[model samples]
Target: MTIKSHSSRESRNPRDFNDPRNKPQERSERPERPERSEWASRRSDRPEGATRERTERSRPDWAVRTEQRRSPRERFEGGDRPRPPRGAGLLAELRELDRDLIKMIARRSRMLTRLPASGASDHERELRTSWEEHASAVSRDPKLIRQIFALLQEVEVAPADMEQPTAFNLAPMRKPVNVDLPAPASDRLPRVHMTLAASGASECVLHGVPLNNPVMECLKGLNQVGARLRWEEDGRILCQGGEPVSGYSKSILDKVVHVGDDPFNLFLILFQMVTRPARLKIIGESGLKFVDLAPLRHFLPLLGARLTSVVPGQEGLPARLESSAMLPSEVAVPADLPADAVEALLIAAAGWERPVTMALGEHPEGRSVASKMLPILRDAGIEATLTDAEGALSLHVVPGKAHFGVEPGTGINLSAAAALLALPALAGGSVKLRGAWDATGDDQTREGVRELFAAVGLDMRFSADCAAVSFGEGLGEDAELPPLKPLTDLSGLPSSLFPVGLVLALIPAVRAKGGDLPRLPQNTDMTLVESFLNQLGLSCEDGRLVSIAPASTPWASPSFPWALALSLAAFLRPNIKLVNPGIVTNHLPWYWNAYNSLPTPSLARKSAEEEAAPAPSRPARRRVLASHTPESEMPDEIVYPDED
Candidate 1:
C-alpha cells in the first residue's frame, strides 16, 4: 500500500548524525563538483541538485526502520488504511518501548564482555532466567499495546564472553586453480513469470534467492501503479494485480516527479498501462543518461498518451506519457531499445483492445525479454505471429482475452559454465551443463553463452533439453584470448557474464588491462559489476571502452562471484568468501553451489601470469551467426550439431 521510492530513500538525509560517514568534509577535502550538461532552458527544468550525491555510489541504502504512514485521504483507497503516526502519543510509547528493549539487550550484551570465562555459564543462566521471566510476565499480564514487547522475548541469550568479530580477507576464494575438471549446472533459482490475471493477484513468487535491486525496482514499478505487492514470509512477492492509478491522486513521494535513478527494464511500460486521467512523467538519471530513448518517445505517443511537452535530445528520460484516448493499431519498434526498456512495452502492446502489429526491424538475438515475450504474449490470448523476410523479423499480434495456464519457464543461465571453464582445474577436463534449454525452447541466449566459451578452447554440445562443453589439453597456455570480448547483444546471458567475459578474455593477458566493451543491446547495468568489483578490491570506471582495473591495493574481496571466479581462475588464488554473496540470487543463485563444486586450479604447473601476453591490438568485429544454419556455412568453432 505504501510505495518507497528507492531513489528518494537513498537520497534521504541520514537520521543519525552520529554515523562516522556523516562527518562534515573539510573544506579542502570536498571533491570538486564536475561540470554537468543538464540542458535546463528554464529554472524548473533544472535537475534536482541533491540528485548527484544521492546516486554517486550504487551501494544500497541502509535499511530504514521507519514505517511509511499512509495519508488519511490516501491515494487509491476505498476504506480506512490505518497508519501509526510517528512520535505522537501512542507511537511514541512504542518507540520508547523499542528503545528500552534494545537497551536491555545491549546491557546483557555488554555484561557478556565483562563476565569471566569461568563464570560465563552462571551469567548465561542468569540472562536466560531473565528472558523467561519477561516472557511469562507478558503471557500473564498482556497489555493492549503496539506489540513492542515481542522484541524482548525474541532476544537471543548471548555467550557471557565469546570471540570478537574480526574482518577476514576473502581474496583466495578466486585464486587461480590448476586441476583436471568437470562442472554441472542446475535451474535452482525460483522462476519469475508474468501472470495474465484479469482480476485478483498478479503474484510473482520468487523461486530462488531473494529479489535484488534491479528486480525489486522492476516489481516496485508494478507496485506503484496499483499492484498491491508484499513479501510473504515464504519469500514470495504477492501482487494484487490490476489496480492502476486510474486518476490523479497523491503518493507519499515528494512532488518533484521523475522516475528516480534506478533502472526499471521492461517494467517502464507499465506507466502507459496505468489507468489514465493520471499523468506519469519518468525522468532518467545516472546510468540511464546515455540511453537513446527514441523508440519510446516515437512510439508511446502513438498510443493514447501525450509526450509533446518533452524536449527531445535534452532529457535522460523518454517522452512523458499523459494518458490520452486515441490508440494506434500499428506501430514500428526500433532496433535500438536496451534490454531493460522493452519488456513492459511488449506486454502493454499485446493487451491492447485491437490487433496490434509490431514491426521489429531486426532482432539480432532471440534471447532478450522481447524474444521471451513472444510466447508468453501468445499464451495470454494474444495471437502472436513471427514473419522474417531476408532475416528481418516482424511480429503480428492479434488481441485476445488473456487466460491463465502453464507456460514455459526462462532458460537456465550458462554463464556459470564460462566461469567454470575458465578455472585452471579444467585445463584438460570436460564440462557439461544440464538445464540449459527452456521449456519455451529459448536456446538462442544459451548458444551465446556457449559462443563465449568457444572463443576460448571449450567445445560445446546441445540436446533437446541439455548442453555440455569440454576444454582441450593445456588450454590456458595456448588460448590467447582478448580481455572480455565486447558485450554486444548478450542474447539473454546474465549481465554479470559481461564482466566474466572480461576476466576470461584476460586468460592469456593477466598483465593487460581490459578491452573496449560494446554497450549491449540489453543496456547492461555496469553498476552491479562495479559494486561487485569494488567490493572485490577492484575499481570499476565506466566508459565506452572502460579500461577495467583495481586500485593498487593488494587484490582481495570475493563479493562478485563471476568477478571472483574470473580473478581466481585467471590469477590462481585461494578461494575467498563473498561479501553479501547472497546478492547472486538475483541472476545466478545456483551458481554459488556450482562454483564450489568446481575443482580449484591449485595444481597448475604454470600460472596465468606465466603465460600472459599483451592484449591483442585489434579492431572490434561483429560476428553474427545465422540461427538454424548449415554446418558447412558456419565456422568450425561456432557450429554445434544437436545430437538426436
Candidate 2:
C-alpha cells in the first residue's frame, strides 16, 4: 500500500544514507526556561558576576548566627536537658542513711574506746541487746549487726589498750604427744531423750549421751519446763516426764531457753511447746540466730500454739511460743517442711493425749531424716504408719506408752567425725573413730564418712569396737599416693558435713591446679565458704576450681569446719597459722586437746631427718702380735706348696 514512499523519501533528503556532507535543518518551535525565583538567586549586595556561595558568605546572617550561640548552662536552664531517673530521690535518701549509719558506728567505736575497761562483760551484754533491738527496729539482720560490732571490738582504740580480744593459736601444740581421741557419743542421744521427755513418756535411762555444753543447755531448758533430767556419774541421763507449766506467771528468765545454735534442740523445744501448754522464750546462738522459722510459725497455729518473734520484724529466735490446751487431732503438715522438722513433729505427736493423724503430702526418700526416725519411733512403742494415698503420703501416729527399752546403740557424732577424719591425712598419724554405726539402723552418715576418706585414697578399717582411719597400703608417703579421685556425687553427704567435705575436696583441686569439684548443693548458702576460699587465693564458681596462687595466711573464723580446714592446711604449707582455734569448742569441746596431742608435721620431718643422719664413729681395735708370730714361724715350709 505504500510502494511510492522510498522514492519520495530519497527526493526529500537528496543525499545517500552514508554521505558524510549531509546536514539537517534546525526546528524553531522549542520554548526557553523561565527566570529563577528570588530564593534561588544570589544576594543583591554582591557584584553581578560573583558566584551565589561568595554572595552568601558576605551576607549579614553570619553575624546574627554568631550572636545567637548559647552556653550549655543556658540550654539546661531553658529545659533542654534530659529527664532525671525514676528513683533518683529515693536512691539519694538511701545513700544519706548509709552514711549516717557508718558515722554512728564510728562514734560508737570512739565512745567504747573512751570507756573504762572495768565491767566489760556488762557493757558487752548491754551493747549486744541494744544493737539487736536496733537491728530489729530498722528491719536488718541481727547476725549482720552482731558481726559488725564484733569487728569493731577487734579494732584497737589506742595502742595502750591492754585488754585485746583473745586470739587462740595452735602453735603451742606443734610438738605434741600421741593423740588418742575419746570415743564420740551419739548426737541422736540428746534428741532421743528430749523427744521422749516431751512426749510425756515415763522416766527412762539413756546411756552414752555426752554431757556437752549444747546437751547440758538442752537438759537445763527441759528442766526449767518441769521435765526431770539429771546426768548421773555413770554417764546415764535419767529423764522423768512432768507436766510443763503454761501462762505468763513464770519469770521471763525462767521461760527463756538458750538453744546454743542447734536447730535440733530448737525443734525439740518447739515440740514440747505443742505437746503441752507451755509459754517459752527460745533463743539461738551462732548461725541459728538467722534461721527463719516462718514455716513453723504458720504450722504451729494448727496445733493450738502461737509462735511469735520476740523482735518485731525478725522471724527466728529469740522468739516466744504460747500454746492453748486444745490440741487438733487431724493436722495437715506442709509438704516442703524440712525432713528434720518433720521428725521433730512426729516425736512430739507421740505425747499428744489423743491420736493425731498427720497428712504428710509426700513420701520421703530412704536418706531422709523422717525415714530413719520412723523406725526409732516404732521401736519406742509409738504406732506410726507412713502411707500413700493418690501420691499424697500421710502419717497416722497413735499415741502409746513409750519407753527406752534397750540402750540406744552408740553412734559417732557427725560433726566430730567429719573434723576428726581429716586429722590422719594432715598430721601423718592414724585416728580411731568410735561409734560409727547408728543403733537406729541409719548408717548414711557413716557411709559419708567412709567416702570422704576414700576420695583421698585413704583406708578406713571398721571393727566391732571402732573405725580406724589410716594411710592405704603402700601409700604411707604423700608422694606415693595416687591422684585424688574427683568426688562429683555428693548425695551421700549431708549439707551439715559439707564444710569439711568441701575443704577436703579443694585439697586435690588446688594441688592439681585444675580438676573437677563437688557441685555445690542448690540449697546451701556458701557465703562463708566462698569468702574463706577467696582468702586462700582460689576461686570456685559453678563447681569449677580456678587456682590463683594460694597464699599461706593466718586463718581465723568462728566456723569450726573452716578453722579445722585451715589448721589442716598446715600440712600443705607449714606456715599457715590457725587463729581462734578455740572455735572448735562449738562442735568438739576437746578438739584442741585431741588435735594438740597429735604429732606435728614439722616434728615428724625432724624425726625423719634424724633417722637419715649418719651414726657416730666407733674406735678401731689393734690385732694381737702373738697370732702373727706363729704364722711367720710356719711360713718357710708353707710357702713351698704349689698348685697342681
Candidate 3:
C-alpha cells in the first residue's frame, strides 16, 4: 500500500467499478420490479418461517383477510331485487273496491225496501240461513256470521223511508205513584210448591195468592208438572197433589216450559226437574234469554245432571237439561258461585227429602241466602240444620214429620217494596205501604228500620203497628240534608235496597276519589252493573257513579226490577227517556198505573205545607197513645215530618 501511495481518489477511480461500497445495494437499483408471482417464488431472501409474520406485519389485520371487491350500488341493494309497486296507485284501487262494495250493499238494501214486509222477512231469513251455511262450509264461526248478517238486515229493513220515519212514542207518565206494597210472594211460593210436591194425595187451598205474572207463570208450571191446579170460589187457589209432582215432566206442556224472566221461577222449576230422571228444554224471552247460565254447569254435575246452552257459541237460553236421577248425599259448593245459584241448589235439596249435606265455601253472602232459605224450608216442615265448623258453612237438610202453614206476612215482597220506598224516602217524600208486617221477623222491627235510615243521615219513624214508614218528608224544602254516608257493608241489606245503597255510596266514591266499589259478597259483575247505571243517567267511571244527568237516548231495561229502578232514578233526575214501558207489565201488571199514581214532589210539598199550616185560632191537636204518652207535645209552629 506504501509503494502505491498516490492520492486515494486517484487510486480508487479505476477500481471503483469492482468496489462493494461503490454500487447501489437496493432492489430498486435494477430497472423495474418483477411480477408478484415471481417475487413470491423468490422466498430465499426471507428467513425460513418469517415470511408469514413479516407479511402480516407489513399489511394491517383487516387487509390480511381476502375479500371480493363490490361496487356501491351492489353493496346497498343486497343483491338483485324486484322494483316496488307504486303506493298511490294501489291505495286508489283499494278505495275503488271499497266504494263498489258499499254501492252493492246500498242497492241490495233498496231492493229489500221495495219488497213487501212478509216477503222481506222470508227473504232475510233465507239470507241468514245461507250466511250461516256458507260460514260453516268455510270453517268460520257460524254464529258470528249470523250476527253480522242479522245486523245488516236490521239496519236495512227497519223504517224503509229514512226521511219520513214512522213515529213511535212511549206513553209518558204525569207523576209517580205512592202505593202500599204487600210482603214478597217469594217467601210463600216455596211453601206452596213444597206442599204440592211433597204431600201424597193431599188437597190444599191457597188464598190471597198474588196473581202477579211470575206467580201465575209458576202456577202454570206446577199445574203442567202434574199438580191439579184450579181457581176456587172466593178467589182462592186449590191445588190437589196426585202422585209426586216434582220428579219429572208429567204432561206434554211440561217438556218445554217458559219460565219468563223470573230467576226464582226458573231455579225452582229447574231444581224440581233435578230430583228425577227427566229432560226439559227450557226457554225464555227478553232479559232471561240473555242470562249466562255457565256457573250452573259447575254445580249440576254433583246432582247427576247436565245443562247445555242450545244456542251455538252462546251461554244463555234456550237450554236443555238431562238428569240421571242419582244425587250425591254430600256436595261441596265453591265460594265463587252466585247467591241465586246457591239458593236454587238448596231448594232442590229440600225437595229431595233425603238427608243431604251441603258444604258452602267461604262465601258470606251465599251463607246468608242459605240461612234465610233454611227458615223457609223449616216453615215447609223440612228439618234444616245450618252450622259453622272451622270457618266453613254447612247445611244438613232432612224431611220432617211436622208440616207448617204459610205465615201472614208471606204475601208481601219487603225486598222490592223497601227498594221502591227508598226512592221516595231519599227524595224527602212519604210512602204509605200497607203490607202485612211479619210478627216474627226483624224487618218490621222499628228500631232496625230506624237504624238503617239513620245510617244514611235520615231520621225515620216506624209506627208501633209497623204499618207505615215516615222519614225525610219536607226535607227537600229549606232543610239541607247531610251528605249521604257511604255504606261499606251491604251484605245484610235487603236485596232491593242494595242497589239504592250502591248508588248512594258510589256517588261520593267517584266524585271524591276514583276507585272500584267495595267488593260485593255476591261477586256480581260490577262492570255490567256500572255500565247499566251510566246508561240510566248516572255517569259512571272507574267503577263508581260520578254524576247524575239526564239520559241522552232511550234505553231498554233488561228486567222489570231494573225498569222500576230506572223509572225511580229518572224521577230523581228528570228528562231520561226509557223505551219499552210495557215490559214491566210482565211482572207488575198495574206497574204503570201505580207508578204514575205518586204525587209530584211539588204537589207533595204543597200538601205537606197545607197540613203543616195550623188553624188560625185553634192549636194543633195531637193524638196520644195511652201506652206511650209523651210529657211534651211538638210545637205547632215547628212542622213535623209527614206520617200516615
Candidate 4:
C-alpha cells in the first residue's frame, strides 16, 4: 500500500476512488468491514471432532496426539497466517501498520543518533516533519506509538477505518497525567583560576588531582620550570612555586618532555611563555584513560607551540606534543576542542603581553567548561566578550593580572556521586551531598547522569548547594528492582563516570541471574576497578562475570562511588578509613564532607595486604620514584598496544 504525502493526498485523481480497493470507504460502510470475516464459516463447515476422528482412524494414534499438543494461538494463526476472506482489507491494514511502524522506528532512531553529533540538516528536519504528520494521522493522543503497536498485534482494528463502535478489541487505557519538571541548565561554572595577585613568586595550587598520575605529573612539569611542590599529610597540596622556567636544558632536547601522568592542561600556559624555541611532550604512560587531547594539537600551535602525533586514538591515550617559542595571539577555535584545553588557554592568556581572540564555529553556550569560563574571566578583570555573527562565536579576551594562592573548588560528579549516595542509600533514607555548587555545576555531566537514572525508577533534583533525591514512583519494600534498560547511546554519560555507573547497574543483573561479570569499559579504567574490587575481597574474577552471592549486593565493584556505595548498601561500619581515599578527593575538594554527610562511614574497607604491610621505609616517599626523575631517570618502558 502506498502512503501519500500529507499535502497532496486531497488532490489525487477522482478515478482512483472508483475501484474502492485503492481508496478507503466512507464511515457508513464500517459495519460491513467486520461482517466480512469468513473464518467462522470455515470452522463451522467441518463436523465437530470429525476431522480429528477421521485423521486418527486413517493415520497412526501418535498423529492425533501431536495435533492435541499444539497451542491455541498457534493452531488458529499458523506460523504463517493465511489471508482473511472478504477482500482481506483488515489483513492489508495490519501488514501496512507493521511496515510503517518498522520503517519509522529505524529512521527515527538513526536520525536521533545523528542529530546530536551534527546540527540538524534539511533531511533531518524533513524526516521529523514527516514522522510527526504520520503520527498525527494515526492518533491525536500522546499514546499513539503504543496504539500503533496494538493495532499491528490485532489488539485493536485500524482506528482510521473503524466505522462501528466495537471495531476495537483493545480496552480504553486510563493513564495518569505526569507533569514534567523544568530541565536543568547545562553549564556548571566550576573553573580553576589563578590570581597572579598572590605574589610575584608565581605560586598556585590546582584543584583537579585526577587519580595520582596527573598530580605527580603536574609537580614534575612545574618543578622543571622552577617550582617546589609538596603533598601535605592532610591531603592538601602545598606548592612554594618559584619563577617559571625560561628555557629547556640542552640534555632535554631531541627527547620527549615525559610529563608523566600530569594533566596536559599544564602545557597550555607553560608552553605559551617560552622566550625561545623549545621541545615539549605530554605523555599518559602512567594512565591510559583521559578526555580527548587532540584538540590541543590544534589549539597550542596557535600559541606559538606546534604539536605532533596525538598518539591516542579515539580509545587510547598518552598524546605527544611539540612546542615552539613564538606565541599566536589570535586564532579561530578548532571544530572540536577539549574543555580543559579551552580553559587552559583562557587562564594562560592572562600572562600574555597582548589581548587574545579565540573564535568558534558555533556557540558552545553552557555545553562546555570553556564557555562558562568566559564570565568568570570577565569578573576577574580579564576583558571578555562573546560575539555572534551568522551564528558563529568569537570570544575576545583581554589580558589581566594573574593571581596565585587561589582555590578552585569542587564540581561533584553527579553520576558518580548519585550512584554513590542515592542508589544505595534508598533503604536508609535521604542521602545528602552538601557543598556542591549547583549554579556552576557541570551541566553536561549532570544532565547525562540524570537522563540515564530517570529511565530505571531513579529521580534526582537540584537545589542550592546540593541535590535532593528520591526513588521513582511505584517502588517499595519487597518490590523487585526495575528491569535493566538497554543503553543504545553512551554519549550522554561521561566516560569518567562509566565505571561507577557499571557498578550500580550490574547489581540487578546479579540478583536476577545469580552473577554477571561483564567487561568493564576498558577505556575508562574498568580493569583498574576490577583489581580494586578483588582486593576488597568481593567474589569477582578477572576476565569473568561478577557474582553476587553470600553477602553480595547484587553488583559490587572496586570503582570510585560504587565501592563507596556498596559499603553503605550491604555493609555498615561506624568508623572506617579507605586505603586510597584520594580517588574521591581528586575530583572533589570537599570529599570528606561529602562522605561524612552520608549516614554512615562503611566505605572504609582496605585490602588485607594494605592493612598488614609494613610502613614505608622512608620518612617521605614520592609516588613517582626519584630514579625516574629527569636527573637520573630510568629508560622508557613504553607499553606496546599488543601487550597483554
Candidate 5:
C-alpha cells in the first residue's frame, strides 16, 4: 500500500538480508582454516594443557636443534675434524733440538781425536778448556736431560748395525824366544854403561841400543843437551829429570840410529826411568868413544842452562860441563813417535824450558848428528837456530825469547823425518833454506817439502833448486828459530837420505797443486806409506808409482778412517801405480801381499777386419725439385728412403 512514498525503504525489510552489497565477502586478508580430518580438528579443539603436551611431543627440543644444526661456512671449515693433542708441535721441535745437540758433541769428539801430539798453545789450551766447560754444561742442561731419555728410547726402537765379528775361536800362536841370536864375536867392542836423568825416563836406558855409529853420535848430542845421564854398571845407564828436548834437533837425533828403526822402542826404556838425579855424570871405559859432545853446545841453552867449555889452557877441544837447573814450571813432552831411534830421544826431550842446542859445522860430526836430531827437536817444541856461519842449530833456552834465524840457501836434510820434524817448527817460525835436494838430486823432494809446508798452513817458498822459510812471530815465544830437518833414511850421506821423507811428506802438497816430486828410490821401504794409506782407509798396489781411477768412493771402514777422503786417494795412489813407503819396516806383513796383488792381462788373438774397420764408402745423392706436389699429382715418388 502507499508504494509510491516508501519506495526505497520498502526494499530494506527483513527479507532483504541477502542483499548483494551487504552479503559477507570471501576473506581476502584473514587466513583460511586448513582442511583437516575430523581427528585433527578435534585435536586442535583440545584443552590448553593437553594441546601444549601434544605440541611438546611433536616438536623437537631447542637444545637438540641447536646441537644438530651448523652454519654452511662452519661445516665447510671442518668444524667436525679432529685436532692434534696439545703441545705436539713443541715436542717435535724439542726432538730436532736434541738431535742437533748430539751431533755437536760427536763433532767435538772427532776434533779431539785429531789433536796434535805436541802440547797445545796457550790459545789452543784456553779454547779446549772452554770447549770442555761448554760440553759439561750441555750435558747438564735440563732439555738435554730430557733429550737423553728420548734418545735412549729411539735407540731402543732402532738399533745400529754393527758389522764387527763377535765370536773368536782362533788359536793363539806360541813362538820361541831368542830364535835368532847373533854369535858373540871376540873382536866386538865392550858394552859401556851410561846413566841419564830427566823428567821422563828417556834418559835412563836405550833399548835395542844401536852399535856406536854416526847415528848414535847424533843421538848422544841430543841426550847430552836434554837430560842428565851417567854411566852405571856395564852396559847400563842411569837418568834423571831434565829439560824436554826440541823437535828442531830431530835430524841429529835420527842420525843416532839406522833408518826404518822404531825410535819409540829405543826410547821407551829411557821414558820409563823415574829417578831424578841432582848431579849425574858418566864414568865408563868407552863412555867417550861413541860420545860426541858437540850437540851439548846447542842442548844446554835450551834447558835454561849454559855449557861452559873448561879449557885447560886450551890444549885441544875443551872439556864441557853441560848442566842446568830445572825451573818450577813443567814442560810438555810431545807424544809423536820419532821417525828413527835418534829422533825419538830428541823428540822426547824437546819440551824443556832450556832445550839443548847443537852447532852444526863446528865438530866434524855435528852436521851428521844435527840431521838425525832435527826431526825429534822440531817435534819436541824446541827452537833450533841454525847459525849461518857454523851450520849449527842452537837449542835456545830462552823459550819466550828464542828466535830461529836461517840463511837463504841453507843445505839442510829434508827427509820425511826431517820434514815432519821441521813442519812444527817451520809452521811457527821464519826460515831461509838453500841447496835442498833429494838423495837422488831431484827437485821433487824439495817441492814436496814446500807442499807440506803449505798443507800445514806454514809460510814457505821453494824454487827449482832452492827454498826459503820464515817463522811467524806467533809461533810460540822463540818463533824466530830455525827448525830441525831429520833424516828419514841414513843408508848413505845426508845428500842421499834427506829427500826421502821430504818427498813423501810433500805428496799431498804436490797433489794440491803445490808442486811435484821425483820418483823415489826403488829399494826405499814403503811401510810408512802403507801405514798412512791404512790410516786413510785405502790400500796400495803396484810399486811406489801408480795412478788412481776417479770414481772410487766406497764407504771406508772405521778401522781405516781418514780425515780427508781425497787426501787418502791422492797420497795412497800418489801418481798411478807409484807407491812409496818412506823408510820401510821388516815387520810390515802387508808388503808381500800388496806386491803380489798387482793386475795382469790375458793374451788373446784379434781379427784383422775388426782391427782395421776405419774406412767406408759414401753414398751419392741426386738433387730433387723443391715443389709441394700432392701424391695424386706426382707421377712417381719414393715415400721412404733406405738407409745404406
Candidate 6:
C-alpha cells in the first residue's frame, strides 16, 4: 500500500478510455472499482453454477441491444429498426390507378340506374348532364387514364355515342330513301253492296270491298233466291222487294264485295239480312261470320227464303225465295213486327178490322223480339200462335178456347202478341183472359210497353203483386173517366196478366168510358217516364227509385210524331191511352220556348278571357336554350337541330 499507485484510467479498457491521438485527453487519478463478475459473485448467496447462469440467461443480449438502433419510422414508433426506402414513382402510379378505377366504378354504377333520354324524367335528365360533365373531367385527368380503360371493360358504350366507321371515303346519309313503286290507294279495289230486308218493310244495306282478308271467306254458302238488287253509282246496292236473283249469276258477282273500314258493321247488317232474307248470295268479298250463320238455319224458311244444301266440296249454297200467288195486300201482315213496321202495314191495310184484341206475356231471356201479341179472333175459338218472321212476329189468331196463361218458355214476342190481343178489348169489345198475368219486373223494356199504353189514355192499374184492367164499356167520345194514378206492385203475377191488364184498361179509356189512370210519355220506356219527370222540372237522385211531387195538372199530352203514335198503336193497340188535351196544351205555351232555344256561351267566353291574360312578373333569369352548337357558335356534328 505504500507503493506508488498507477492511474485508474491506465487500468481501464482502451475502448472505454478517451483517445489521446485524436484530441488532448484529460486524466484523473482515482481508485479502481472491483470487477463486475467479482461484485456479482460477492452479492449473491446462490451456487455459482446454476443461479448465476440462470441470471445471466434472463438478461437481454447484444443482439436485442443492437435492435434498439431503429431507422426514422421505427424510432418514432419505439420499435425495431426499419429497412431502407424503395422508389416512390411506381407506388404513386399504382395508387392513382386504384383511385381512378374506384371513380370509374362509381360512374358506371350511376349510369346503370339512369334511364334513356326518351324515357328520362326531369330529375334523370339533370343527373345525366352532371354524369357527362364528370366523365369528361375524368377523361382529361392523366392519372385516371388507366382506370378509365379498365372501367370501359365493365360499361357498354351506347351505340348512339359511337362513331360509325367506313372502309373508304364515304358520303353522308341522304335525306330520303329511293323507292321505285308508288304507294297503294285505299279505294282502288272493287266494292259490292248487299241489301237485307228487315221485317218485310225496311232494308239494311251493307257495303263490301275486296280486301281479300281471311274474314271474307264467310260469304260462301248464301242463297240468292228472290232479291232484286242493282248497284248504284256510289257503290251502294238498291235491293227492292221482288223476285230472287239466281245463285249462279256470276263468279265475280257471286263473290261479295268488301265494305270500307268498318267490317264489323257490315257483318252485323249481313247477319240480320241473311237470317230472314228471301234470297241471299255473296256478290263479293263482304266480311261475314260463318259460325254465327249456322244457328239461323231454321229461320230462313219462315222468312220466305229457301236455303239449299251444298255438296261436301262446294263452297256456297244457292238460296231461293218461295213464290206464292198472294199479293202483299192479300198476305196478312204479322202483328209482331217492330212498332214502326207494324204501323206501316196497318196504315197500308186501311180496311183492317177496327178493334183487334190481343194477349201479351213476358219475353223470355234469349228471345230476339222485344215483345209479342197474340190475336183473339172473335168467331173462331182457336188460340193464337205467334212466330217471328223477319223483324215481325206473325200472329196466327184463330178463334178457339182462350189460352191466356204464360208458359215458362214464353218470350217478348209472345208478350207483344198478347198485348195486341188485349188492345181490341180496350177499344170496345168483350174479351176474357184466363190466368194471372203481370209485366212488372226489372225489365226496362216492359216498362216501355206499359208506357205506350198509358200515353193513349188507358185505365191501367198495378199492385205490388198484380196488374188489373176493367173494360166497363169502351174508349169513345161519349165516355168519361176520373184522372189516372201511379200503380205500385205487380210481382208474383202470371205473365199473361200483362196483356189482360192492357186490354181491360184500353177498352174503357179508348172508349172514353170514365176512370182515373196513369199518364205516360210517347217514347214508352222507364227512361221516358224518368225523362217526363225531368222535363217537368223534377230531379232523380237514384236510378230506379224516383221521387216526384203530385202533378199540378191531371195528365200531359205526349209530344211525338204521328209515325211514333202509329207504331204505338200497332204494337200496343187499343190498350194504348192518351193524356187529357187540356194539361198538355196548357204546358206547351209556357215550356216550348225554352226547349227551342240554343244554350248561351257567356261563361265559356269569360273562362277564355281569363286564360288569355298575361302572367305576373317575377325575378329576371338567364334564358338557356338547348345545346345545338359548339364553342365556335357553329352547329356541332352531333348536335340535334330540332332540339333547340
Error of 5 at 198 (Å): 12
- TM-score of each model, in listed order: 0.48, 0.64, 0.59, 0.45, 0.21, 0.20
Tell me the lDDT of model 6 at 565: 23
Instruction: Report the number of the highest-TM-score candidate.
Output: 2
Which wins on lDDT, candidate 1 or candidate 6? 1
For model 3, residues 567-642, the per-residue Cα lDDT tens digits are 6555444455667666666545555554555453121224777788887899778998677546586454767799
| Model 2: CA > 4 A from native | 1-182, 232-234, 240-254, 286-288, 363-367, 388-391, 422-431, 436-442, 451-457, 461-464, 474-479, 541-544, 549-558, 599-644
Q: How accurate is candidate 5 locally (lDDT)?
A: 0.35
Candidate order (TM-score): 2, 3, 1, 4, 5, 6
Candidate 6, residue 56: CA error in Å?
Answer: 99
* Candidate 6 Cα outliers beyond 4 Å, as residue runs: 1-226, 229-481, 489-530, 543-644
| Candidate 4, RMSD to the unseen true structure | 24.1
Q: Which lDDT tens digits does candidate 1 get at residues 1-644?
A: 98988776755367878776778889999877544543333533746864444544443444221112544445345435576566578887899999997787878555556668897547645665565567665565333221222233234555558764333233333322333322222222222243233212343433332444444554555455555656554445554555432223322221124343454543343333432444555544443443455555565665655553243223344345566535567666656655545555555554455666666665343235546667666654567877767755666776544454553333344455556555532244454444435542234445566676666545666666655554443445446422333334333445546655655543332333333333443555566545444332344345423333443333333334454454444242233334344445544444445455444432124568756744468556779887696868977576669999
Tens digit per residue, CA lDDT, model 6, 507-548 = 333333223333322233555444433322243344232334
Span of ten consecutive residues with least summed lDDT in model 5: 181-190
What does the lDDT read for residue 142 in candidate 6?
36
Candidates 1 and 5 compared by lDDT, better number = 1
Mark the 10 consecutive residues where model 4 has the least summed lDDT: 168-177
| Residue 126 in model 4: lDDT | 60
**Residue 330 in candidate 1, Cα distance off native in Å:** 0.7
C-alpha lDDT values of all predictions: 0.47, 0.64, 0.59, 0.48, 0.35, 0.33
